[model samples]
Target: MIALPFAKSGSQSFLRGDRVHLRAPVGGDYKAWAALRAESRAFLTPWEPLWNEDDLERGAFRLRIRRYQEEAQSGTGYPFFVFRNSDSRLLGGITLGNIRRGVAQCGQIGYWCGVPFAGQGYMTEAIGLVIPFAFEQLRLHRLEAACIPHNKRSTRLLEKAGFQREGLLRSYLKINGLWQDHLLYSLIENDRRSTTNNKGAR
Candidate 1:
């Protein structure tokens, strides 16, 4: 098992990396969360599903928190909000969703970084933190991620985090306002172990 060196909580599962920490979203985060999303609207909207009219409102955030809590309580998914460690500023969010257990033992990884935080490696560190959480804490066999084929930044971040490109998913998800193709990538437990071993051997 991989040892998580930084920090982790018992139930809340707050993850801490060298530069960032992730905790489940709560009602109190509404203001800062809304502000970041509003500022990064143009950078994020194109890659995300169409947002509701009141998506940034407090009521909507509360509803979203409820949904996330339900998903976690049901053991179907886990969501975390990424924050900068230095000043505790909100940077973005990441989630391990659509979890499948039994024979599959897999889950999908999804995330978004605010425009100002993009290209600064915060998302990469966030994903690095989640990998162990998925493979060790959750005991998931595989983790999958998908991004639009032309999204170079997303592709780079995934590759940097050790995800291997699998295939193109034709019209796999509805992004913004239209269905679009996506590139699928995955990192399995054995693969992660092998990578770790190789790095250690070198």
Candidate 2:
């Protein structure tokens, strides 16, 4: 596994973009994260796994943070909270998970935006920031994403980010309590054009 560098403060360095920054979620973020998820429940439920009744509770958020940290330390995943650079408000989250190294240097990318922030280009910019971090920082060769076939917004976002439609996975995941098919998409390191011209964060 590759080691990720961290700042002296023990916080992971930020990945900035034109208007957003992606960073690991801290303890203080629980409130905002919970509020946003609560507010966007309906908007996000369709694309996410079935939520438990206490999914957004503080205890659950703490558990999530602990798991995120463990995954980061184990070099198996990197989770980030997207924030507006201007006001530092949480906008959404993007994660690079299931990292595979050696013969297959790749990972899976997944993301979601606050309902109010959806379609405003936040996730696009966030994805742009994460691509380089995955390729250059994490030394991964490819990133893959999957979404329901009817999720035009997600499919378009993947395409805009330079991911090619690879194939379909029948009943790939149980989303919102039922099996759902998904369209697979991928981006390789050689395909720099997709993210390079997107004005990555400094």
Candidate 3:
């Protein structure tokens, strides 16, 4: 991917953590993004919805970028590409979608890591960065995530990042071309704050 551009004032638009940074995807990211996803197809397919044959094509990617930009601009959702801070390598992606305002200030969080990057702490760190962005910048009250019961890695990642397992949903989503059950998890703003406070009190 091309180097991310900065504003003339030099403020960073991307969310930065110790090991990774989250940035909006650009047109140039198509190549690297496609390659990474293609390489990790088997690893990711099971947890994700079935992919169309043209899913990795540039046209489809461009459409994705456009939709993400629109969503971000409209405060409906925020999409980010996860990159390693040391080398700026694209590792995966995370998104806060289905944002609801007014009476319900909540959004759904989803993420994936490349096969090669799996088992590392990259995804956990990425979630840490996104939570602050969702709760602080977006002023959201709660973030929800769901994972297949069999996806132990994802379940562990969510739990490690402080999400509470709420329950299980039967045939909750269509993943890998079939309806699958998911374990629901959520992190509320007050819960997060309490956790932080408790840690600081230690």
Candidate 4:
């Protein structure tokens, strides 16, 4: 996993991993981000919220960066873009958002990988990078994620990453313009330690 420290000031973080690195979104990334999202629209539309007509426009991208910064400053969210380490190509995006502190100490995680990079384990490693950030730097106690029931790939990914299925949420999220049933999953700070301990005992 990447070892770079997260600067609370929202400065650029170089979270490097084996094949991918994660960093905060920047205005300069507009072109590559847009092209990848545009080309992967068909591949991604099924799982994501409906995109606005101007979602990929430069102006919209600018506002997105602003919102991300605002959330960062407020200590409620963090958004990162995944890039290939070899050439620094944009591969995907991930966000640990809606953080709740003051006892809850929890957050939600979401991500997407462009079609060209899908199934290549980039998002998986990207997820690994964020888990530590959420649990250690942010000191979050729990992390939650949900996806449509039919998205078997996501289910497998979450499970492989040690997230346990919590339950089903009927009409949980609007995806591709329709309400869909989503299966919720969660991981807590102790789960990692328990797994490691079990491995040692074995």
Q: Where does the lowest 10-residue lDDT sum fall in candidate 2?
A: 4-13
lDDT for model 4: 0.89
Q: How many clashing residue pairs, candidate 3?
A: 0
> Which residue pairs in candidate 3 collide?
none
In terms of lDDT, the best-performing candidate is 1
Name the Cα RMSD for model 3: 3.9
lDDT of 1 by residue, 32-116 (tens): 9999999999999999999999999899998998888888877788888899989889999999999998899999999999999
lDDT of each: 0.90, 0.89, 0.89, 0.89
Worst 10 residues of 4 by lDDT: 1-10
Clashing pairs in 1: none
Q: What's model 3's lDDT at 15?
A: 85
Model 2 Cα lDDT, one tens digit per residue, 2-88:
554432334644788889988888778889999999999999999999998899889988899888888989999999989998888
Q: What are the per-model C-alpha RMSD values against the true structure?
A: 3.7, 3.5, 3.9, 3.4
RMSD (CA, Å), candidate 4 to true, equals 3.4
Q: Candidate 2 at 115: error in angstroms?
A: 0.6
Clashes of each: 0, 2, 0, 0
